[model samples]
Target: MPGLDYFSFAEMWSPLFLVFMLLIATLYAFVVGPWRQRFGGVEAVPVVRQLAFYGAMLLLYLVHGGPLSLLGHLMFTFHMTDMAISYIIVPPLLLYGIPGWLWKWAFGRAFWKPFRLFANPLFGLFAFNLLFSFYHMPDVHDWVMTHYVIHGFFYALLLVVALLNWWHVMCPVPEWSRVTSLRKLGYIFANGLLLTPACVLIIFAPEPLFAVYNDPQVWVQAMGYCVSGDPARLLEQFEGPAFFNLMSGREDQQLGGIVMKLLQEFVNIWALYSVFMQWYRKEKSQEDDPAFDHAASGRLNNV
Candidate 1:
């Protein structure tokens, strides 16, 4: 296998981003531990929640600033895998990991009220899917990839919308949950359905849709964001992204789409099972309650 050892350590590991992630993790530990009293935390956070938060941070670092990030630049498959992990997988983990008290403390301020509209189920549903699909459009993708500022901004926007979209399903704060358990199932289904068209376009296209992957010149230009040294040297040393890719452009593109779709389905299935079980358990608990039974009988007798 072609190894990434050829690349500089900075390019492969992104030391700056690594430091940023570590700082954030350290800050989180403090905020949830020593600083919890200042934040009005009533009790210690669960160990499982702490683990999930750290796990989310680790995954984020691996995909964005680790070897996988470098691989993503060289191959369409890894790029799509990065996308799946970033938007689909990471958001839920973050939502589940963070404590409800922290969520309230952070967003409970009056200034944040205006942004609450983003939490609307309908807005969350369409905004993320629309932006996600729009981003994958060939021209848009190429333009964004080539422009560093726009690339960073757009990705940040995607992360925000992804967190918003997932908020309905994860609902870290029980009181803040907008969608019912039954509706959350529908939300997951709608998410899978909305993302299908984009995946289909990538999977079934006769030719590779992205110039950055197929054209050496464009590929090298995009490399500027990930590679530290002069971009010109990249073409001289490695020739192009093709030097690193093992499959044909079309095959890589198809495989990327397939991988993304499969991962989405897998996450959605787990979400469905979770929501269904929650609903089932709630109903069962209600059934076993004498008060609930009496209320049910009273309502039925009145009807």
Candidate 2:
């Protein structure tokens, strides 16, 4: 008999993971509030920024530490959903939530010169897409899911690259920004173009592209990453991912590709809109401001 209890809390509740999430939240609260004065008189973050940080952490827990994580191991579709939320959505929240002063302090060190290279609008666009695409290559994918440590390390790298990719556009630290309005627009559009090939390959592949979903042996081993208990018992109880699958593996892979692209598009579209609105408002503000010179001031006021 097939079962999805491997993804069920009844069988595999992750209390340790829950504790870890709570610990992070507590740390964030202290850092942005009572801990600020201790950090060389860094001011408290705005309430809205505080909410973004907390909310991002909460979503991280829900998606990665709770049922969604188990679901990710269960199916490729859910796995892509996990990636979308974690890599695409969470980093922006973090960028926005952290105070600019804190970012200044962090990147002020000489160690970040390497990050500056990757964080450039032109390079970030190419680097993030290149790394992201490489990670999905079937050979690379098999190697990672087979090794939990490598899997964790690879995604951690992706998260870092993701943060760098978004830096030029949403850089909380003003001094760090390297792109102007036109370049920002070009950078985002280029990113969308660069990433499309990965999704297109996944979506159009004639067969399932990932070993973790298509091969029962690899699938079972991958499940071991999430499913707890004895190997012998686990093997006896479950046959493969089919035990938990609701759709054919091919369909699952295709759907996963589509979902990833759509999620990426949604985030990019919002980013473009935010950039446009900010630019519009800035131009409006400039037009309204009276110039310092008398004649210029009079002309601005008349306009």
Candidate 3:
């Protein structure tokens, strides 16, 4: 039977092709317009910084939003490798690539008042984690797969959470600009730690948390993508039906749990690198400073 095919999963790659073109165009615009205007007046940032931020964004987009997303859609696992990395990992890096002025021009003006109100640290920490937790709830996850609007909304909400969580770490408000290199590093690690529970739950689960993982109808419904032809093909390759039959629900759960743990490990490594490098540069700066004395040395030592 040709399944509902509502999402046209096979064609998932099509939109990304268009998006890739648009992304290139946007990158060009940023480079030629805002990036140029912003930096033209000031000393250019080091090539290394630019490369690290830009290269990271470009690479992340390629791996997550671009081809990898399409591949995940086609493959149908929705496993931890893509979900954690795409949702939890990539947004911060992408935001880091945007020039400060561009961030100010874009989100800092019209939305500033409302955004500031909503993005308080307390709100940010709760709202993001709360929304994230709820979105992955089985019913909500299923709903997103079934309807385009819900799916888009979920993605948008995820973006908002990502932006909020990253605000203090990457593009902090002026009032809160006192974040030193050590502080930023700590922030990243904190986030990595915060994500551990979710990762562990998914990775060590006795069974799949989401019902869609086991049932084809529910899975396809939740995926909102139609499958066709051989039910066997869909069962064998895409839905992990073979594994589902062979393993206890507890075993399935544990698989997801493990995958989440691995995902956190990746995030931990990346975040550690980001924080350490930031602090390292600050250390280098202090070392080069003539004002450095015993007290300053003590402070550095404390850091």
lDDT per model vs. reference: 0.90, 0.79, 0.57
Identify the runs in model 3 with alpha carbons over 4 angstroms from their true place: 1-12, 20-35, 38-67, 70-77, 172-178, 226-253, 292-303
User: Which portions of model 2 show Cα errors greater than 4 Å?
Assistant: 6-13, 40-43, 113-115, 292-303
lDDT (10s digit) by residue, model 1, range 1-303: 484777888888989999999999899999999999888687788889888889888889988899888788889999999999999999998998788888888998899988888889999999999999999999999999999899989988999999999999989889898888888999999999999999999999999999989988998889898877678687777768888888999999999999999999999999999999998898789888876775675574455
lDDT of 1 at 88: 91
What is the overall TM-score of model 1 with all chains considered together? 0.95
In candidate 1, which residue pairs get closer than 3 Å at backbone N, Cα or C atoms, i.e. clash? none
> For every model shown, what is its TM-score relative to the native structure?
0.95, 0.89, 0.70
lDDT by residue for model 3 over 143-259, one digit each (tens)? 665686767677767777876776766652354444555666766666666666665655555556666555666554533333345334555444543332445555655655566
TM-score of model 3 vs. true structure: 0.70
Q: What C-alpha RMSD separates each model from the true structure? A: 2.7, 4.3, 5.6
Q: Which stretches of candidate 1 lie over 4 Å from their true place?
A: 1-3, 293-303
- At residue 40, candidate 3 shows an lDDT of 38
Which structure among the candidates has the greatest TM-score? 1
Scored against the true structure, residue 28 in model 3 reaches a CA lDDT of 48
* Residue-level lDDT for 229 in candidate 1: 69
